[model samples]
Each structure stands twice: as C-alpha cells, then as structure tokens.
Target: MTFENTLHFAQQLDRNDPLRSFRDRFLIPQAGGKELIYFCGNSLGLQPKAAREALDRELTVWQHLAVEGWFMRPDQAEDTPWLSIHKRCKDPLAQIVGALPSEVVPMNNLTVNMHLMLTSFYRPAGQRTKILTIGGDFPSDQYALETHIQARGMNPADVLVEIFPREGESAWRGEDICNAIDTHRDTLALVLMSGLHYYTGQVFDMAAIARKALQAGVPVGFDLAHAIGNIPLWLHDWQVDFAFWCSYKYLNSGPGGVSGVFIHQKHHNANLPRLAGWWGYDEDSRFAMTKGFVPMAGADGWQLSTPTVLAMAVHHAALQITAEAGMDALRRKSEQLTAYLEFVLRNSGYPLEIMTPADPAGRGCQLSLLVHQDGKRLFNRLVEQGIIGDWREPDCIRLAPTPLYNTFEEVWHVGQILLKFRT
Candidate 1:
C-alpha cells in the first residue's frame, strides 16, 4: 500500500476486523492528555479496564474479611477461601498455553519460575553437562543460565553454549538449531531458547526443535514471554519437556503479574527433585500437615507457596479475554497487521530494516526494526509525537500492534511517523 493509499486501506481493515469490539475493554494510555498510538505490547501491554475491577474485588475482600477470606469458599465452610482462588484460574491458563490442565501452574515471576524449572530440568552430568541456547536471548535468561551453572559447581563458559546468528541471517534457521543439537547431542544436556526472540521478534521452531532435541536424547524448553498470547502454540502436541512465561506482556495481566510454568505430563511423575514448597504439596493432605512431601501431581507440583490471588485475579481476567478471542483468530489478524506495517515501512525511503521474521508462521505481532545510525533520534521523535514504540540499545526499535487493542489506522499512522525519519 502506498503512502497516499495506506490510510484508506487501514480504514477498510479496521471496519472488517472481527476482534474490533475487544479494543474498548482497555484504558489506552495518554500523552499530554491525548491518547497515544501504543505499539509497545511486547514490552508492556495496555491495561484492560477490567483489571482494576478484578483487583478491586480482592481489595474489598481484604477490607471485609481480613484473613478469614483465606478459607471461605461459597456453600462450603471447608473450602480454602482466598487460597483456592488461584485454582479457579488454572483451567483457562492451561487452555491459553495449549497444555493439559494438569500440566500448567500459575506461580512466581518469570526469572524465578525459570530458576525453579532449571533446577529440575537442567541436571547436567558426566560429559553431557552443557546447556545450549541462542545468542541475543533476553538478558534475564542469560543471567539465569550463567548463575545456574555456577550454582551447580560448573564453569559458565564450559557449561553454557550459545549458537550465534548466521552471517546474513537476522534470526537463526531451524536447520541451524537442529544441526547444533545433532552435533552436540553427546555433550548437551538441554536446549533452552526463547519461543519468540526479544530483540529480533522471530518465533523459533519450538516443535521442530523439541523433536530434534528429544531425538538426540536432549530435553527442550522455551521462554515463551513474547509468544504466549501473540501466537498459537500446542505445547502438549509439540511434546516440549517444559516452558515458562510471564502473564503481564501479551496477556495484559498488569505489570509484574503472576507467571506460570508448563511441565509435560510424562515428566510429572519422573522422580525429578524440584525446589518444592508447601503449595506443591497435595492439596488434600496439605492442611493435614503431613511429614513428607507428596506432590499435587502434574504442574501444580511446581508451586512453591500460596499463590498471589490478587495477581492471579488480574491474569484470570486477561486469560478470559484471550479465551473469548481465541488464539488462532487473534493470530490471523496479527499476521495481517504486522505485514501491513512492514509494507508501509518498505515504501518509506529510510535506511530501515525489519529484523522480525518475514514468514507469518515464524513471527508474532512484534516487528524489531534496525534504523542504521539515527535509531535513537527516530525513536525519540516518534515517542514525542505520541506514537509509542519501544527502543532497544544500539539501533533497534520494537513495535507490536497487539490484536486485542490496536487498530489498523494506528498501525498506519505509526508507519507514517517512522517514514518521516527517512531523511
């Protein structure tokens, strides 16, 4: 679509968007008392208007019942009250991540969940002690891997292997990931990579990588922070060993919201020693005050303590929205919106380059762009104009027109402002 024609096309798209009604649910942020065109969902999603109400319900409980709210289930004087509220969200959370209800658990923040998962999954021994991951992964992941290695009495350099991007490739190909697994099979303990890379916005081939990793006797896992709500995933069908994600990003669960973990059913009873706590104990026997730990079976076995119900309440609201929209339906529109953004940028005479995968199956709504030398200036200018997209250091700027709240016209307008930085 040309610059003159882009607006018309965008308006046409907005009219036809099936998910258009969902946008009204959020309280879009404002700059200078005017609404900003937000395309930064990859970093932090726009707040759903329902979020405040959901959290408010908890506040009301706190005001009235105080600590009694912890044990009062409706129609049952015995049901653990506020404590059981977290369980209410389990099914929807599981459905959103494409896992069995038993395979997913709402728990701590992202890095803490990763550490917990790694404690169980990253048991490198003998010669196969190295963990393989992609370079340019999110910094938290890098730190987690390094610190985990040292904690295991292993040298980070010797036990952590990062495969660099190919010379001309913006993101590593599936073949390269498979090759790395095949070549290092004898010595590699695990393959951990971002489901959608934070810097490049490229969706890695999780199923393909999982298949290869399993075939090579290696367990595979993903950091799904950027992929969970932005794309369709089949973790159970993919036969992934494990995965984890924070709900605050694409799930719109508010900042520092409750995160979760997924453990394949096969591993739930595999006698793996986890960093367990009271919450992981069998619910039936937890209050009985047993001597030894009897895990609650499946993903609940990974929980460490009583859940943050207020945080979980916000996440439940977000997941309910996602469930209503359906992952496939949102993804269908996301592909078109992102592609349209790319199309408009190509027509602008700027030294701009889109680093996100061009293939729809290999990407989400996020598009990470390289702006040669004036990236920071261009990014600041866009922000000043109330066209909000996030900037990463060096030269990359990231934009994500999330399907839940972003309009096609917003996408086009952001593109127009980006085009202005060409000269």
Candidate 2:
C-alpha cells in the first residue's frame, strides 16, 4: 500500500475506511470551535457519546432507590440488579481480552488489581523467589513489584530481575526475554511484563513469553495497561496465569476508570492466598454473611470491595462500543492507521527516530518518536497548533492514532505539521 503525503490521499483512505462511522460515536475535544487532532489515546481515550446516558442511568437509580439500589432491580428492568451491575461488563470485557466471561472481572484500578493478583500469584518459596520484569515498565508496576516483595520480608534488589535490551537497542527482543526467563527459571517465582511497552509502543510476544515461563516451571502475568483494547489478546489460549488492565486508555472508560482482571480457569478453584472482601464471597450466601470465606469461583473471587457502580457504568458503555466494533476489525484499522503515521513521519525528513518496532505485529496504535534536538519545543508547538500528542521526559513524544476516533486525514495533517516545524 503506497502512502502519499497529500490531503487527497488521506481523504481517499478515510473514505474507504470501514470503521470510519465509529468515529462519530466519540466526543472529540475541540478548541476555538475546531476539533483538535487528538493522538493521546495511549494516555486517555476519547469519551464515548453513550457514556453520559450510561452514567445517568446509574445516577437515576441512586436518586430513586438510594440504599436499596444495591440489591433492587428497577421496575422496568428484570436483569440489571444494582448489586450485580458490574457483571454486565464481564462478557464484553471478556470478548476484548479473549477470556471466558467467568474468567474476567471489572473491579478496582490497575495498580490495586496488580497488588491483589500478585498477592495470590507471586508466592516466593525456596529456590523460587525472584520476579523477572522489563527494566523500565510503567512506574506503578515497577513500584508494585518492589513494594510487594518488600512486604513479604524480601529485599527487592535480591528478588527483582529486570531485563533490558542490548546496547543501542530501543526495544526488547522476544528471544532475549525468553532466554532471560529460562536463565533465571530456578529463582523465578513469576514472570511479569507489560503487553505493550508504554514508552516504546513495542508489543511483546505475550503468548510466547508465557509459554517460555510456564515451561520453565514459573507463573507468568502481564500488566495489559496499554494492550487490552489496543490489540487482540487471547489470555485463555495463551494460558496466562493472570492479567490486569486499566480501562481509561484504549478502553476509553474515563480517567481513573474501573479496571478488568483475567484469571485462568485452572486457578478458579485453587486455595490461593488473597486479600478477602465480602463481595468476593460466594454470591448465593453473600447476603447471609457467612462465617468462613468461600470465594466465588473464577475472577470474581478476587474482588476486594463492592463494585464502583458509577465508574463501571461508564466502562460498560465503553465496552459496548468495543464489542460493536469488534477487536479484529479495530486491529485491522489500527495497523493501517499506525502504518500511515509511520510513512508520514519517515517521509517528513525531520530528525526523528521511531522507537517503536517497524513490524506491524510488534506494536499497537502508538509511535514513540525520539527527537534529535529541541524535542520539547517541537512537542509544545504541536500542542499549540492543536496537534495533541504526549511528551515523555528526556526526549520522546508519543502519538497514538486511535482507531475509534482518529482519521487518516488527521494523520496526514500531523505529518504536514511536523514538516512545517522542521522547516
């Protein structure tokens, strides 16, 4: 597919995009009566127009039922009990992450869910005490690994093994990661990694990593913070022990929205150690307030507290859009959108180096650019001109042409802006 650096070519691509109509479903941010070209979906996704109605329904329920909203079903509806409202999100979320509905649960924030999952999965014993993770994963995940190890009366320096790329390399090689896992197999209690690196936009081979870790007698987990809605995942088939993701980014729930968790069915009935809460108790006898803790089967057993109904409501709306568009179709568009951006950037003749993998299968919607000089100035200029992409400290600018809202014309315009700034 030849890409042209012209408005007509961009418009032609947009006109032929099957998923183009989905763009209207989102609330695009505007400035001075003009819509900004938003490419920050890697940080926060555009809001779905249906989110307002979804949130309002929950608010209305609260107004009428108050305390009873927890257990009562509305007069008009038979199935949507407030007490089990989060359950409505399970199937759609399961579809997105490639899991059984029972294996997925929408609850808590990303880091908190990581803590909960780590409590159950990261059991260090005898020769197996270390956790292998990427060196510069999202900061919260790094902190979680360190603090969790510390909480268990272990020194993080002794128990945490961080894998880094070879010299002069911006992204990790899948073979290197598997070799690292195998090398430290004896001391590795768990292999924790991000599905898509937040900094470089490199999509790790999660299934291969999981297979390598498990073959070496280690449990593997992924922080799918940047991967969940951005790419297609098959957690169940991959046999991942556990995974967690925030809905606020590619999922587009909202800022600090509820997260989703995936636990393999193999652990559903296991007597795994976990932080206990009433909502995690077996639902049939939950209201009875039983004496002993009998966790509900599957990922629901990992719930720590009552569901955040309002946040989950917004997430539910977002997941509905994801379901309607379908991951396969969304991913197809994402590849084309990202490839177009890459073409434009490479042709702009700017002193920019794309840090993300060149292979389409090895990245998501994001392209992290390593600017040569005055990078921050360039980023600010883009911001001032309403070309919104995020800047990481040091010298990287992250742009994500989100398939749900962003168009090819926007990508072309961004390229023109980059060329203009270079001049």
Candidate 3:
C-alpha cells in the first residue's frame, strides 16, 4: 500500500479504517485546549473511558457485600466474585497470548511474576548453572535476573551469558541469538529473553529462539512486557515453556495494572518447585487450611497472594476491548500504523535514525528514533508542540502510534511538524 504525505490522504485512510471508531472509546490528552498527538503508548496507554465505570461497579460491590463479595450466590449469575475476579481475565488473556485458558492466569505485576517464574524454571544443577539472555534488556528484567542469581548464591557475571549486538549494529541478528543459545547450551540452565526488545523495538524470533533452546535441552521463557497486545502471539502453538507480561502499555489497563503468565498444560502437574502462598493452595482444600502445601492445578498454582481486584477490574475492561477487536485485526492495524509512521518520518527529512527493524514483522507499534545533533532540543520542541513522544536517555525519541487510539492523520501531522520545525 502506497502512502501519500498529505492531510487529506491521512484523513481518507482514517475514514476508511475499520478500527477508527475504537479510538473514540478512549480519553485523549489535551494541552491548552488542543488535543495532543499521543505517541507514547509504549510508555503508558490512554485511559479507557469505560475504566471508571468498571472501577465504580467493583467499589459498589465492596460497599454492599463487604466480605460476602468473595463468594458467588446461585441467584446472581452476573456477580464478579472477588474470590475468582482475576479468572474473568483468563479467556481474554489466553486469546491475546494464544494459549489455552488453563495455561493462563492473570495475577501479580510483571516483575513479581518474573520472580515466581524464575524460582520455578531457573533450576541450576551440576555444571549447567547459567541463564542465557539479551544484553541491554529492560532494566527490571536485568535487575530480576541479576538479583535472582545473587539470591541463589552465584555471581551474576559467571552465571549470565548476556548476548549483545555487534558494535555497529542496533539490533540482535536472529542467527546470532540462535548461535548464542547453542554456544552455551550445556552450561545454560535457562534461556530468558524479552519477546520484543524495549529499547530498539526489535521483535525477537521467539519461535526460533525457543526451538533452539528447547532442542538443546534447556528451559526457555520470555518477558512479554513490550510484546503482548502490540503483536500477535501463539505461545501454545510455539510450545513456549512459560511467558509473562504487564497489562499497561498496549494492553491499556491503567498504571501498574495486573500482569499474567502462561504455563504450558504439560507442566501443570509437573513437580516444579514454586514460591507458595495460601492463595495458590488447591481450591477445594484451600479453605480447609491443611498442613501440607498442595498447589492448585496449572498456572494458578504460581499465584502468591490474593488477586488485585481493583486493578484486575480495569484489566478486565481493557482486555474485553482487545478481545473484541481480536489480535489479527490489532496486528494488521499495528503494522499499518507503524509502517505509515516510518514512511512519514523517513520522508520528513528529519535528521534521525530509526533504531527499530525495517521489516514490519520484526516490530510492533513502536519506532525508536536516534536523533542527530540537537536531539534533546528537537524532542523538547515537539513536546512544546504537544506532540507527545517520549525521550529515553543516551539517544532515543520513541514514537509509538497505538492502533487502538492513534490515526494516520496524527502520523502525517507529526511529519508536518518535523518538516516545519526545520524550516
């Protein structure tokens, strides 16, 4: 599809877009009585207009029912029981991540879930005591891996095989990642990688990476904090061992919303050790409060505490929208939105380098730009213009035009701003 650099053309594309109306459902940000072109979905998504109502309903339930809200009555079939509030997210979360309902459980934040997954999967035995992962990964993931290794009484420098890109390259090459997995396969106890790189917006080949590690007899898992909702996933089909993600960003579930995990049903009954909590005890025997710890079947067994109902309420509302839009539709729109953004930026004559992959399939909605001279000043000018993209340190002006809320016109207008700003 050829793109034209005109407001009329952008507007025409928006008018014909199937997902256009979905934008109206969100509350857009405004500055000085003018709407800002929000390209910061990679950081935080705009609030869903329905989020308020979702919260209010849950608050009312707490007011009216108090402790009774935890139990479901035979009378009101529609009641969202607090005992299983997070369960409402399972099917939608499953559909989003391409996993079976039994394989998904929406619970704690991303880092907490990552810690839990690390506890179960990062079993260091004999000579195979290392974890293979990407270098310059998201800070939280880096910290989690570093601290987890330290907690297990191993020096991170010795136990972590961090695969970094070549000096001139901005992204990790597929073969490079695969080779790294093979290089340390014997000493590697786990292959922990981000499904999509947060800094460069590079989407890793999860299928190939997972296959390589598993074939070499090493366990693998992904941190999908930047991948989920922005791109389509098939964790079940891909046979990914386990994965976790936050519901902010592309998922649009308010700030620090609940996170979820996918554990293949094959491991549901496996005697994998976990950091146990009362909430994860077998449901039937949970109230019995027995002496021994018998975990609930599947991913729910990893849950460490009571569900965050208020946060999950927002997540439930937000996920309902994603489920309704469908991942295939979202992916299509995401590709187009990103491609159009790239086309506009490339043609704008802006002195910036795209740090993300050129191939549409190798990225999600984000396109990170490494600006040239006066980079910080240029970013500030755009912010003053109410063009809301974020500036990451070192050198990155990330613009992520979300499919659910952003439009082609906004992308075109951003190009216009850059073009005029130079003149």
Candidate 4:
C-alpha cells in the first residue's frame, strides 16, 4: 500500500476503517477545548468513557451494602458479588490472550506477580542454576530477577545470563535469541524474557522460544507487559510455563490497574511450591480457618490477599470494550496505523532512526524514533502541539497510535506538525 503524506489520504483510510466507531467509547484528553491526539498508549492508555460509570456503580454498592458487598449480591445491581468479582475478568482475558479461562488469574501489580511467579517457577538446583534473559528488559524485571537470585543465596552475575542484539542492529534477531537459549540450555534453570519489548516495540517469537526452552528441559516465562493487549498472544498454546502482565497500558484500565498471570493447566496440579496466603486456600473450606494450606485449583491458587473491587470495576469496563472490538479487527488497523506513521516519518525528511523493527510482524503499534540530538525538545514540542507522545531516557520519542481510539488523520496531523519544525 502506497502511503501519501496528505490529509485526504488519511481521512480516506479512517473513513473505511470498520473499528472507527470504537473511538467514541474513550474519553479523549483535551487542551483548550480541543481534543489532543493521544499517541501514548504504550505508556498509559486514554481512559474509557465507561470508567466513571463503572467506578460509580461500585462506590454505590459499597455505600449501600457495606459489608454485605462481599458476600451478597445487590437485588438491583448488575455486578457480581465482590467476593467473586475476580471471576468476571477471566473469560474475556482468556479470549484476549488465547488461553483457557481457568489458566488466567487477574491479581496484584506486575512486579508483585513477577515475584510470586518467581517464587513458584524459578527453582535453581545444583546443576541448573542460571536464568537466561535478554538485555534491556524492563528495569523492574531485571531487579526482580536479580534480587530473587540473591535471596536464594546465589550471585546474580552467575544466575543471570544476559543476551544482547548484534552490534549496529536496533532490534533483536530471532536466531540470536534462540541460539542464546541453546548455548545456555545445559545450565539454564529458567528462561525469562519479555514477549514484546517495551522500549524497542519488538515482538519476540514467543512460540519458538518457549518450544526451544521447554524441549531442552528448561522452564520458560514471559513478561507480557507490552505484549498482552497491544498484540495477540497464545500463552497456553505456546506452552509457555508461566506469564504475567499489567492491564493499564493497552487494556486501558486506570493507572496501577491489576495485573494478570497465566499458568498452563499442566502445572495446576503439580506441587511446584509457592508462597501461599489465605485467599489462595481452597475457597469452599477457606472459612474453616484450617492449619494446612490447600490451594484452589488452577491459577486462582496464586492469590495472596483479598481482591481490590474498585480497581477491577474500571478494568472490567475497559476489557469489555477491547473484547467487543476483538483483537483481529484491532490488529488489522494497528498494522496500517504504524505503517502509515513510518511512511510519514520517512517522507517528512526528519533524520529520525526508528528503533522499532520495520516488519509489522516484528513490532506492534509503537514506533520508537531514535532522535539523536535535541530529542527532549522535539518531544516537548509534540506535547505543546497537543500530540501526546512518550519520551524515554538518552534519546527515544515513542508515538503509539492505538487502534482503539487514535485515528489515521491524527497521525497525519502529527506529521504535519513535524514538517513545521526547523531542526
């Protein structure tokens, strides 16, 4: 498809988009009574229009029923009892990530879930003690892996084998990653990697990596923070040992939204060892105040405490919108939006080196531009012009035109803004 840097071309694309109507479901941020072009879904998604109503409903439930909100369902209200609210997100999430409903569990934040999964999955024995991971994964993941190794009385330097991209290459080559796994297979206790890179917007071939590690008799896990809602995933079918992600970014839940975990049914009955809490105990007999900890079957067994009802309400609303639109339609428009943006940037004569992979299969909606000089100034200018993009340390300005709300014309307007900049 030939992309023209013209408003008419962009408008024509948007006009024919089948998911265009879904844009109205979100509340676009405004500057001086004009709607801003929010291309920041990679960092934080724009709020769904239903967020307020969702919150209000829960607040009303708490106000009226108080303690009863946990056990008893309100006669007039439509929501599930607060005790079983976690059940509401599972099916939609299972559909979104391509897993069985019992395999997914929505719980604590990303890092906390990471720690819990670490406790359960990262078992460093006498011969197999190292964790094979990539360089430049989210810092929090790095810290979690490092500290978890330390807590087990092992040096992080010895336990973590970091892999890197070839020199001069912006994105990781698939073979490089698979080869690293093979190289470390002998001593590798676990393979921990991000399914989609947050900084580079590079989508790893999770299926291939998972198969390689599993075949080598090693467990594999993924941090799906940037991958879950931004791209389609098949954690269950991929045979990924375990995975977790936050819902705020692409799922468009509120800030610090609940995170979710995927544990394959194969591991559900295994006595893999975990840090258990009362909520993780068998639900039917949990109130008996038992001495021994017998976990609820499947992923629900990972729960550590009582659930947060208020946060789940907003997330429930956000996910319903995404599930309604479906990943197939969203992915269709996402490829076009990103390709169109890359075309615009190239033709605009800006000397920006896009850090993300060129192939749509290797990337997502985000196009991370490597602005060598004065990158901060350019990012600030975009913000001043009502184009809400994200900035990272050293030199990256990320623009993510999400299919849920962003329009092709908005991407065209961003290019128009870029054309006016002198430097």
Consecutive 10-residue window with the lowest summed lDDT within model 4: 71-80
lDDT of 1 by residue, 186-218 (tens): 999999989999889998889899999989989
TM-score list, all predictions: 0.96, 0.98, 0.98, 0.98
Which residue pairs collide, candidate 2? none
User: Against the true structure, what is every candidate's RMSD?
Assistant: 2.2, 1.0, 1.2, 1.0
Can you write out model 4's per-residue Cα lDDT over 1-423, one digit (the tens) per residue?
888999999999999999999999999999899999999998888899999998998898899899999987678666789888989999999989989999998999999999999999999888899999999899999999999999999899878998889898888888888888899888999999999999999999999999999889899999999988888888889999999999999999989999999999999999898999888889899989969999999999999999899999898999999999998889999999999999888877876899899999999999999999899999999899999988999899989999999999999988888888844
Identify the leading candidate in terms of lDDT: 2
**In candidate 4, residue 292 scores what lDDT?**
94
lDDT of 2 at 25: 95
lDDT value for model 2: 0.93
Residue 269 in candidate 3 has what lDDT? Answer: 86
TM-score of 1: 0.96
* Prediction 3 global C-alpha lDDT: 0.91
Clashing pairs in 4: none
Per-candidate local distance difference test: 0.87, 0.93, 0.91, 0.92
